[model samples]
Target: MNDDSRKAGGADQDPFFMRDPEKLAANLARTIEEAGKAAGFWSRARESGMVSDSSFDPFADMLRVFSALGQYWFSEPSRSFEAQTRLFTAYMGVWMRSMQELTGQAEPDKPEAKRPDKRFHDPEWVQNPFFSSLRQIYEVTARWAEELVERADTLDDLTRLKARFYVRQIIDAMAPTNFVVTNPAVLRETLKSNGDNLVRGMQMFAEDLREGGGIPRLRQSDLGAFEVGENLATTPGKVVARNDLAEIIQYAPSTGKVLKRPLLIVPPWINKFYILDLNEKRSFIRWAVSQGHTVFVISWANPDERHRDKDWDAYIGEGIEFALDTIKARTGEDEVNAIGYCVGGTLLSAALALMAETGDQRIASATLLTTQVDFADAGDLKVFIDEEQLQALEEAMERKGYLEGGRIAMAFNMLRARDLIWPYVVNNYMRGEPPLPFDMLYWNSDSTNLAAANHSYYLRNCYLENNLARGRAELRGRKLRLSSVKIPIFNLATADDHIAPALSVYNGSRLFGGPVEFVLSGSGHIAGVVNPPAQRKYRYWIGEVHEEGFERWLETAEETEGSWWPHWQQWIEAQGNETVAARSFGPDEEALDDAPGKYVRKRV
Candidate 1:
């Protein structure tokens, strides 16, 4: 038997190998022999199926043959041939060394010498007469097939006799490059505009290629600091309350007596809360402020190892609970509207559940954006949540005391390997492109680590067991059930979202026994929420609340187009008082400078 086959067996005995050698060898031989037989059979079958004197188009056949040859040459196996050869040689050497050690023939502590260098140019092993003859035969056959394909004249002849063989090769040769169809004049103008710029771009791409890969530049010209209009009146806004980890930033109308209640915005700790209040034109928070409604947003403190034991419960207790009481103290109101995004929404749901169990109906309304409650259908995250993978992750986090943001980013990148990995590799390394500076990519790269305890618990309980969906998730010895929360809910989901698929986000509606307005928006997870009114490309779908299963709701829901944000704004406004007011839920603290507080400046 061949060496590759002979070495395939008893791989389990050697954990690394994990296969049987003799069986593997036999299989390989059988496969090669069968492939040869199949090729011959197909050739005969084709001849038998065709009528005699069938128009033989040698040109078309030649093209097919050449294309096939090119394809074979450029395929993954061919590209990786040298690397695979080196890997196999190294593996064999390691195995030999291991066996020698086991037999007491080699000293365990002795390091082996470096392997001798070998080159494909050498005429040692490959100089065999048998191999030379086989190589000649292969070349001749390939050439003859190519000549046959290329000689074909008619399209019909090519299609019937030679198209399949050559088409694949043509595709392979053209595959790596991206092509955009446009007017020839426009294309030519674009190419000629700046030769120097093109040269520089190519050089930069080459540099990136050498470095490994390049990141795509996200459009950031439209993004900047918040800009409030001159006509917009400034209001009396303050930090109505401060907690152990956060401060509530509240804004109210400057000219009027305040409404009794207020709106509370809960943003995910993963990013700064400023996303809602980005600028005058796009800021949803600022828009709410302009509408004269009382607004209070939770600013989460940046955490470190000192906060290692802080879990979901602490977030609810010190974060949301603290803010709720502070708002109450400022306004003297028992209930207020709450809006939560992503992880914040998750925590809000839990808090609402806890409050319901204790008969505390303090939440007048609830809005969840891109939040997940039922993790059973959490989508792409499923790849990394298996028991063994989780255990390995836990061990890794245990070593570091926390899970680094970089590790989390890596996991996310894996989900979109082609877009995230391959494009970068080709652009940076092969095409020689420069690094593109993009704010979105920058923020995405700016990851925050998760505490070991919190991460482990979240993965095991929420993701693996789907505990929240099953009503088995517990916090602080209190059973947290989604059904307990009966408040009016506005749930927003995004199409083209990778993190939370729209259907999965709709699960929140089923989990909560309340009036639900499921709104589907255009764009991805982040962009969908950050969508400004001026952008014309986006659209949304509004579905009536259905108490039935997520699948059933989808079946019954009608499709619509346009931004869901407007619908959301209208719905949320309807639930609250329409009159203008300078409202505060609790007593104000010492004045804080602006909307985005100190917590946002903290490094992730």
Candidate 2:
């Protein structure tokens, strides 16, 4: 606990360290050397375009942001002076507080004044004077840097977003908790284990680097704890059909009789479809079946170079349309209810427009879960959609034919790096502990690749150009318009969603020509939509859709406790409540595979 004790390698406190410091030191040195070699290999691979996507240098953008900030501040001498004085004043306050603490003259910080940070939850961070001061300094510096960006009024909206985002990244990366010596939890573990934790951690670091094929894929959950069909995606079903882009999985009937209009689920291709079917307890597909709805899900293929030419047209034609045709063939049904999650909903909306143009009316109703048809109010994800980044991304996809799943996974993880990236970094690499087995995290880790043409078109039309909402989007040489799609829509948006902001989803709801019932749910992108009624977690809002604005709608909306599953089921049944005998896959339509088809099983 003292300087001398620390300098003596905490040997007096650690029996293992006191007994054999030399052996521990030797092992630490060797492991660190091996880790260095692995890091060197990763660096080389990134340089050679094996790990990284393309020449999209994020650092260049960061520099541009700072340059704008510098120019704005320096434009006026008073402004520059004020900025410096403000930062220094904050530092002075920190120093004064630390002095007071050391002299035992400090009053306890008010609970309201004490900003709760999960990273500094360890008692030592508050109890130890040095760590307490260190935390205050980090907080001060981070706030100052963020304020600099916020005050840079000269920067454009996109540039400001990028600056804020990049600054947060830097501040988070520099946090004391990330480092071993500064992190009391890791330090205690290290001293207790006599440096053995470091050795094991470095070994894992090297192994993960190797597994990633030059990129360090941090394990967010115990990889061996769950498998696709065994425990995770265990819903009973049969793969009724397969094509170039997807497999249509029709789940077995849980009830003797099912709804007349079957339900089809289209999940985002960015990740596997099993998020909705993680287990019996949380499986939406199973829940739907139990509620007397015959469910069919589209399991998109994990693409490769061969799929590089596959564009939006290919996805709509082979994925959505193909599933539609298969669903009709399997069940002697002419119409069906459909649900699309995230980007899949975007694609489905486009397909519906195309179907409208061509007078195809098989889809009776649609449920969009955390989906964004209009990207104007899209959140932090918009930071990655500018022209420069798109070109760089396109170049990378051009070389690889398909964008790697790991790259997509990394981008989403980076959006919430504090929760997703750094905690795993400190636990896996510093404390030397494997992540707990979380089915949601496991599903997140299991990402899927995107074809070059598909990803490019999506970025350009949806995020970059905002063409989908603008009615300028085209699919397969036909102009697609959301207004043309007249089917009733159940639009669900999560209050805390980062990928698809609720406001954006609300804005998108107005674009539909038919009656749109916009529902707001608690939690985020994944949890909000996958919520089953039995859990009794999170709430949902329902009321008349206010076309004016989301705030106006919320003002009149009635909030309900528990999941929105029952509400959704009621809506779907209201459309066509007829009862039919539970149907099985026809003998003509032979089973391609078991439920959670082979396509979902493919890993990048």
In order of appearance, the predictions have TM-scores of 0.60, 0.95
lDDT agreement with native, every candidate: 0.59, 0.87
lDDT of 2 by residue, 1-604 (tens): 5445655775556422345678768868977897897888788887876777347666776787788878999999999999999999999998998888777799623212556788888766776777888888888889999999898878888888888888888898999999988888888777677778887788788878877778778899998899999998898889888988889898988798999999999999888889999999999989999999999999999999999999999999999889889888777788999999999999999999999999999999999999999999898888788898889989988987998888778889988899999999988888878899998998889888899999999999999999999989987678889998889999999999989999999999999999998899999999998898889999999977765698999998999999999999889888889999998656566577888888888887
Task: Give me candidate 1's TM-score against the actual structure.
Answer: 0.60
Highest TM-score scorer:
2
Evaluated at residue 110, the lDDT of candidate 2 is 24
Candidate 1, 45-96: lDDT as tens digits: 3466421112322344455544554454346564446444544565566456
lDDT of 2 at 358: 95
- For model 2, the run of ten residues with the poorest summed lDDT: 107-116
